[model samples]
Target: MKNVIITGTSRGIGLELVKCFAEAGHQVLALSRNSQPVSDLNLKQVTALSFNLAEATDFETVKAYVNTHWKQVDLLIHNAGALVNKPFSELTPADFQNVYTTNVFGVAELTRVLLPNMVKGSHMVTISSMGGIQGSMKFPGLAAYSSSKGAVITLSELLAEEYKDSGIAFNVLALGAVQTEMLEEAFPGYEAPTTAAGMASYIFNFSLTGSTFYNGKVLQVSSSTP
Candidate 1:
């Protein structure tokens, strides 16, 4: 099948995407900051890698991993993100630096380092947020997180345009709220944010469908309930 690289795969949506793709027989390289403890049961096509996204130089590790293991990557998923909520006054420069380090800087750096090895038909999926689309009552201590996601949307759009003629597809998946540790940690007691596994399947299938004429498109997901 396709060869894929998914960031933040130690947990949440990224993890689910890894399992989904591997189950479907695609070779997947899953990267995360923490060693997520894969069962290591000799699953030939799937792998788990741990590296800190908050550091720019860490990308070299990812680059090396791919260069050493695979010849080409058919898809790249930018899903690692950091979100913390606190008053703007209370948020420190370190907070901004950390959030953007993984959200904007790391995402961009990882993609840039891997782009040369991506073929034209390959696709890139970025998980953004509804907070990036339009501000809502959800602005409780989310300035850094929301702003970083907004930057993700813009970056995906620009890349889409830049690669239009190259046949590379760029898509932004704006999720409403996924019930992940990051979400629960940022906003305590919020029921599950969203289903990571289901969303992963839809995105994978969507890209393969010819509907990709809508490349550079934005797809947003949020909890249907409160």
Candidate 2:
């Protein structure tokens, strides 16, 4: 019954999240660079858009959709992410820029554009990574990706405090390894303890109810250590 917005819905966890919300009978706005996959699903009450988080024009499209269609957004999930797996010495400035653009900057810009449509009690759930956690564990090749994730964690905290009186909640979920295409591309041959559908289900439930107990908090949803 709620109007929900989910980004990165082309494949992996994002794709599963779209299914979870649609099957639950929620009105879903699924955004991704390649929207055809979600378009092919043809789920009732689901609208898939070819959206690029890194592009400012796409945000305008989302604003138009929200203004024209949904009166309010009950939940916004920042599930889109970009990763570059290369040694620090080989990493270029453009590498960091691209990762930050999609992961950090995009999340901020999209939230800004959607803020007016999100009423009191709305929840903004950002999908972060355990690698982003300070003093947890560090990997050599994830300098840009992990740093961008960390930036968002702080950004959510700041937003939660800034918008405390507004009644909107901002929280983060720092996830462990999941068996996703992104994982395969980053760390080949590694088997994860969780699946995309499993994580999606967890996130779906949390988005519905987590605001009651948490705001400006980062829950480390990991069964295994990184």
Residue pair clashes in candidate 1: 86-141, 176-221, 176-222, 178-193, 178-194, 179-193, 179-194
Which lDDT tens digits does candidate 1 get at residues 95-206? 9998999899988888899998888788988888888886544566889999999998999999988888887888888877667778777778877645767777776676
Local distance difference test values of all predictions, in order: 0.79, 0.95
RMSD of each: 2.1, 0.6
Task: Encode model 2's per-residue lDDT on 141-173: one tens digit a residue.
Answer: 999999999999999999999999999999999
Clashing pairs in 2: none
Cand. 2 Cα-lDDT? 0.95
Best by lDDT: 2
Candidate 2: lDDT of 62? 95
- In candidate 2, position 124 carries an lDDT of 99
lDDT of 2 at 206: 98
Lowest lDDT block of 10, candidate 2: 181-190
